[model samples]
Target chain A: MRTVDPAKREAKRLQILAAAARCFARKGFGQTRTADICAEAGMSPGNLFYYFGSKQDIFAAVVEQDGVDTEALFAGLSAAEPWDALTRFFDLVVDLAADADYARLALEISAQAHRDERIAALVAANDRSVRSGLADLVARATGAGRIDPGLDPTTTATWLATLVDGLFNRVAVDAGFAPERERESLHLILARLLRHEAQPES
Target chain B: MRTVDPAKREAKRLQILAAAARCFARKGFGQTRTADICAEAGMSPGNLFYYFGSKQDIFAAVVEQDGVDTEALFAGLSAAEPWDALTRFFDLVVDLAADADYARLALEISAQAHRDERIAALVAANDRSVRSGLADLVARATGAGRIDPGLDPTTTATWLATLVDGLFNRVAVDAGFAPERERESLHLILARLLRHEAQPES
Candidate 1:
């Protein structure tokens, strides 16, 4: 038997996922074939099957990877000042919304989540993870007098998450949305929503 | 020769559309069969086909009817005081969002819009109609000094529409999100966004 390197195997798996993401984004999950993913990944069908048992498995992995990425992002932000961290979070959302492929993939996953119970569970878990992270930041900001103390942290966080969801949907729907151009309005809306008084330095 | 009464014909068409709406909302567009719609409408396949050429035509009509309903709604609200009309608009959104079937159907349509250019064009046209109505309200309010003069009506209207889109999405994704319960918060957020200082008449 040939010796298998775990790290190399993991890398190969990630390569497949990245390719799958592109294919799913371009064609949506139902229309995308595993062969398409293999071609995108520059691998044979056998090699692709060795990593993911089926297309469904590959799609699930893609959504699971989003949860992992979200957690990692929040963990990094948790150490920063709460207000700054929240600001950074919205800025990051704008960046993600600006990426057409990422926005389309997010919409595709959300659409699939509606029809598939397993996918819904995964999406709900990912949503919870995001909302929990946001709630923590909201709590910290309120406690530090950086935001309105009267606001419920969890509800505020959920709305914040909803705003990001809407942003992604706008990118997919509106041809002229221009996420980057809307950054100022987004910041202003956030400040108003949170009752934050911070002004950008001149 | 058999005669078709225009009024009766229109009524039957609406009945079919309403039934189709329920089926699409429950099973989504792809899974919903014309047989299911015919059964739901209490008609035979021949009767259903007489009204609609195919399932695709029926779906298109369903979406087009939504645009018609939306236009009629805005036309009714257009005469009200701008700010009051805007407030009523959000209130109606809460009502629609509270309807599980309506919210789900909206999501299904949006998902389909992503895959079909024709559907996308219809959805986009509906969206533009909505945003234009909202911008008109915003402009009137600004002129009347009911909202912040600094805010561009078109952009403000777009964000307001975005917020409502987010609201519908929240209902779909978050089982705990109660649209009726969130009314006050939504009002507060809108007031703050528009810099309106009006308080509810106590």
Candidate 2:
């Protein structure tokens, strides 16, 4: 019967999500339990249920949160120069791929997406959101003469998304692939792929 | 007490692996039962057990077969011109990615690799084999003046492998990404990435 503070409620929600993310990354969705999530979050089962109904619900919330984060990132980049924004986005990918938990969580979610229809829908929606964001940036860059005029923005964006997906895949499977060390090579590849005029360093 | 024909026995073992691949692709590793594999292979449980100890064993054999197939492919390409061999390799990739079953099976295997250490070891060994094969091709191309001298063969090969992994990922996630249609774009990207003098068409 007591009134819950809105800000505190949101903070508690995020805390639960962060803990669930770690549990999902370490044990995978099939193996992770709600009790484990509650344990990780240092919350009671009753408090955890106040935020999410079931393990499946919590998993769905995790995917939905990723979409929200990605949208927020694009919104922040919207005010920057188009080419710089695109490079900044790739740099962030390098950083995320460098994080072991984030990369493993990505793989876990993707693997679950194959078997769960709900997860697949969420993943596909997230993928579309990412591609559309890239397409908008590509269009802006092309209009500004920073990218090749001949390349279709949508197609270019899709290929760029493929590169991002590939980057994560490399981190998951290859032990020797260091995302930080490959940052320069990634930029060089991007410049070449987009046919940018100046050298990647310049 | 009866003597078994070794060639026939080997052929039957391959038959079971092929059937298991289909079952694993369709239902994923966790959901696929040994009984389902038997039904798919048109064999009794006893016959299936004669060749494999469990679903895990059959899955491992499928991964092992991929390594064998890859080694055979590189052996075939070794006699060709370096650039020509590389292009042929990419062409075959396009063909394989176009197959829904193969692409789905790849995802399944990769997903399983995350939870299973034995599978992880096999996948890692196979990945190393693939990268080494690519490095050899890149080295030959560099020595023949077909590739830029500034590019290190191993690094270049690693990125090229990344593209392959990315291609398969696109197939798994993007329903709109048609591998056959993207063949030309892939070639162009490769040309630009490798700094090949001639256009992809030439």
Candidate 3:
């Protein structure tokens, strides 16, 4: 009749999610079943069911894991100069794409988001949250007259988000593509795109 | 024995690819079996084997079917005005994303491309072709004094390609996301990024 500690319960849930992510990454969502998740978690089926109702629920939880708190990642970005803040965000994405398993899981979730409404909504919300944070940073930069004032913050934010996603796909598929090379290219592109200068002297 | 007509054989291969694309889109590559593809294509397993060696080969053939014909798609793009050509390219992508099944198939291929090297190489090659085509267009545009003369065409091409991929993800995931709306937003963002003069104050 002892009550379980809330912190202890939450910790267990996180442990389950971590294991589930590994299983999902190794074998895609369609191929990974609840039993596989249980085996990966080192727990019995009953114990795993006690935490998540079904395989899809476990998948939802795994996709929602706080792998990268995009908001928190960019929280202090505004303090830096606009160009610096933008490049920092790009570098963070490039670094994250280096983890092959994480990248695989991301690609799987993206594919699922197309068919599953709930998952799609969840991913869209996360995408908006990240874009809003970047938009705020862009707005601040524009206010400070660092970026072209004529640029729409939301549009620029979306453009930047797209750039990150594309880079992730490139990194995930191409083994030889170096993140350092992409980062340098991105810095130059962003500088030329945002600055009003007509011609950047090579 | 009479020889089969070459045109008829080629058409039959295309039919098989189309059916495989549908099956892969509906049931992912892993879940799909050779029998399933044969059934979908209304052919016997032996007949399917005559055309494709295995289920994986069928999947690869299906993916290869969607190969980006850069030469065909961008034939006159370099000769067009810079901003005009870029806008047309973006518009064409938006149009393509409107075909839900095609977009779904593309997403599925991208997801599976990571696990299969042949598929990965195929996807990468398509990416490179598109990037190269965009680079040529960007170079033409810059040389014609459309874009910033000093901007690197390759980098600009990469960013442009990234934007298209990101937009495709958005269209695929968001049920309420209209292709027109997404395309409009993209146009605005690209115009700003390319430093094209904004539509005169109205």
Candidate 4:
């Protein structure tokens, strides 16, 4: 019997997903063939299937990986103050947006979601994860009297999530938009939206 | 000498673009064939080519049409108070978002822009027009003392544009998000972001 190292197998799966992201971003979801992904990942076609069943499966994995990343992001912020946690999350968003391929891949995934039910559901789950995360923070902040009570937590979180989604779209759509410079204004907008006093941008 | 009726030509062009939009939204830009657009438009393939040289050309026209629509939208809003104009513009956005095909087509166009330079330039132009319209309103509002003075008009406009971009994306990505119901929260978010009093959701 051949023994497969579980950790090694998992790492290889991540490696394929990373390569697939690049292919999808450059050629779009429909234009990219499975062979292109295998080529990008520097693996044989047989090796690629060992990790993902097909192209659709790989795409779903990418979408799920995004969900996992969001969960990890929120998990790390669990101990921080609600408002500060949000601040850190937005900061991380800017950091992620700094990578053009990641931002482009996000845009591609959104387009795919529009066409595929499975992707749409996956993206929806990721969005729900984000909104729920924001909602939790908003509830905590409102309870602690850190922000305004004029809006409910879920709605506020939804709109905040909208801003985050829009931030990524802006990065993909506007070449001239520099995410680093917008960080200050993003802070200002979030502060105002939450009705909390904002620390002046540095 | 052969001559064409300009008005009729324009009408047919619009007809073809609308059909193309439907096909692109349904199948995505890459997967959509010219014949599909022709069938959707209810015209012969030759007639379709008379209006647009290639699939790429028709896509560009669709993008340009979006810019024209934006310009028309802002021009129509010219007489209103700056803040009211901004608010009304967002309301119009929500109204448009109610159209699923239009929203999906927008996602397709944004995805196309990421892959094609021609589309990118056109999309950027549309984005700039939106930002400028919002900036013009923001500048006037600040001048009229209608909002906070902490942020510049351009930056405020950019973020506001980001929110608009994000709103469309939310519609595309989140099935449960109803644009009609979001009006009140959107207004509230805008009010908070701009430091204006929010009108209660009706």
Candidate 5:
């Protein structure tokens, strides 16, 4: 057998994850099969197995990939104003929610996370990362005295993260609920929470 | 057959709903069978069918029963001291979260509400009722000058309701996340949001 190229292996892994995400989004985790993923990826069962050993592995990889992509989207933005950063975060989340397939996948993962320990742990880890990142941003803003020092950054971060999750679920269920309205409401809420006195410098 | 008594029929309907709630709590909506509900109720499947045409019907009844119970729980409460009413609301929610079986049932319904239109409508109706009740409370509170009059009662009520939902989900996922701790934080957050000047009445 020829040696597998590293770049080719990485590409195949991503391909399998994308296909698996689509399958999971459509049929749900319980109904989806490895064969279905293989067909979706246009790859043989052996090739699919070469990248992910099992269905759970494929799921974990998909979640990991989502986290990586989200992190990259928000990376290297230290110079931006606090309000701008918050607005960017809300816009990114709304864009994610706009995709029906992605939203379904997220709901499936959340439902499964309730019953499965491994999935719950994965979700918890991902949630912690996001919360910590947000807390860091809050802390920086606090240092600049943009937010009240009395408020706990970590708790506020957790609350904001929870709001994001709730907003995503709402968007998934209610088609009439406009993301623009939500984004505006969130900006106002964040401004109030942060005690921002000046007009947001867009 | 003997003439059916209206009161007795209503009682039986309530009984059936209770049994269905238990079954849904144990096995979830998707996993629960009509037979499972019959077994839970110690009745024949035919009897269960007479009471509810299908599993979905029984699920609907369970939700309707919950709505009635919640309404009764909040009945006769004037919106006088909306902040106090709001605190009481959170306390009641915390108590409900303490009931493990009910908490599971709520989460199951919430998850199913995402995929099923019938369930979604039922949940939305329930949400609307609660929000209106909360708005009444908020209006009274605003009238008493307890909370900031600048904030719209409906919007504040909606936000409060969403906060409870987020807190309940967190409590379900992490047993260590104490409802009491979050309740304290909620009180603080609400005080700030409402711009309460005096110390919150315990």
Candidate 6:
């Protein structure tokens, strides 16, 4: 029996997914070839195919990876104070936006979701994960009296989700937009929306 | 020599553009054909081609029309009280979001803007028009002491732009999301972000 190291195999898979993401972000699903992903990963086509069967397959993996990442993010956030966790969530997005490739990939995934059902479903699942995570935090915070008890958790979660989406959309549309610069204002908006307290920060 | 009536020509051009918007909204730019636009407009390919050399041409025209329409919207809002003008802008977006086709087309155009430079330029222009219009109103509002004097018009304008982008995104991701249902919350967010006075409405 041939021995395949599971850890090594998983690492290689992640390596390929990261490289594929960069290429997809730069070019787009329809325009990028499987060969292109191979070149990005510095692997032979056979090795790449050993893991991902086609370009579409690789694309699906990338989206699935995003869902996994979101799950992991909320996993970490789940343990923290709910209001702080919610604020920290925006901070994490600001960090993500600092990497233009990551930001652009988000836009690409959204664009591709409009065209492909599988991708759309994956995107929706990822979105649901985010909204539900935020909603959970909101419910916790509301119960703890850390924020406005009058705010509906589901609705508040939806708006927070919108701000996150809009943050990426801002990067996509405006070249002059710097997400890092907007962090202060983002925090202010959240404070007012969820905390009902004015954050007097410039 | 055949004489063409200028008013008739202009009206026909608008008719074609409206039909093309529907097709692009329904099928996206790449999937929609010039023939589709012509069929939707109830015109022959020759007639469509006479007005637009290609699908790309009509797409550009639709984007250009959006800019023109925005200019006309701001032209009317220019005379209103600045804070009210800003609030009405959100009202206008809520109305547009009520039409699924119109809202979907906005997302489609944004997605297409990612790949095509010509489309990107047009979309950028449209964003600039929106941001600048909002900025002008913010400036007037601040000067009139209707808003926080500390607020920078352009920055406030950008955040408002994000909200608008987020609104369209919410529609795209959540099937249960009704823009009409969101109108009150949108107003609440705006009031909190801009009005400086805490809006008692949840």
Steric collisions counted per model: 0, 0, 0, 0, 1, 0
lDDT of 4 by residue, B1-202 (tens): 7487999999999999999999998899988999999999999999898888999999999999999999999999999998889899999999988889998898899989988999999999999999999999998887887777766888888999898888889998888899999998787677767754421111
Give the DockQ of candidate 1: 0.34
Candidate 2 DockQ, CA atoms: 0.39
Once fitted onto the true fold, the runs of candidate 2 whose alpha carbons sit more than 4 angstroms away are A198-202, B198-202
Higher-lDDT candidate among 3 and 4? 4
Instruction: Summing lDDT over every window of 10 consecutive residues in candidate 2 chain B, give the lowest-scoring window.
Output: B193-202
Q: Cα deviation in Å at residue A179, candidate 4?
A: 0.8
lDDT of each: 0.86, 0.85, 0.74, 0.87, 0.72, 0.84
Write down the TM-score of every candidate. 0.92, 0.93, 0.84, 0.96, 0.84, 0.90
Docking quality band of candidate 4, CAPRI definitions: acceptable
Docking class of 2: acceptable
Question: Candidate 6: lDDT of A185?
Answer: 79
How does chain A of candidate 1 score by TM-score against the true chain A?
0.95
Each model's DockQ score: 0.34, 0.39, 0.32, 0.48, 0.24, 0.38
Q: Global CA lDDT of candidate 3, please?
A: 0.74
For the predicted complex of model 3, DockQ is 0.32
Tens digit of per-residue lDDT, candidate 5, span B39-94: 88888988777778889888977877777877876684553355677778878887
Against the hidden true structure, what lDDT does model 1 obtain?
A: 0.86
Docking class of 5: acceptable
After superposition, candidate 3 runs with Cα above 4 Å error: A35-46, A66-68, A74-87, A195-202, B33-47, B75-86, B188-202
Looking at model 6, the pairs that clash are none
Which should have the higher DockQ, number 5 or number 6? 6
Which residue pairs come into collision in candidate 1? Answer: none
Candidate 4 interface RMSD (Å): 7.4
Among the numbered candidates, top DockQ falls to 4
Candidate 6 residue runs with Cα over 4 Å from true position: A1-3, A198-202, B143-145, B199-202
TM-score of 2: 0.93
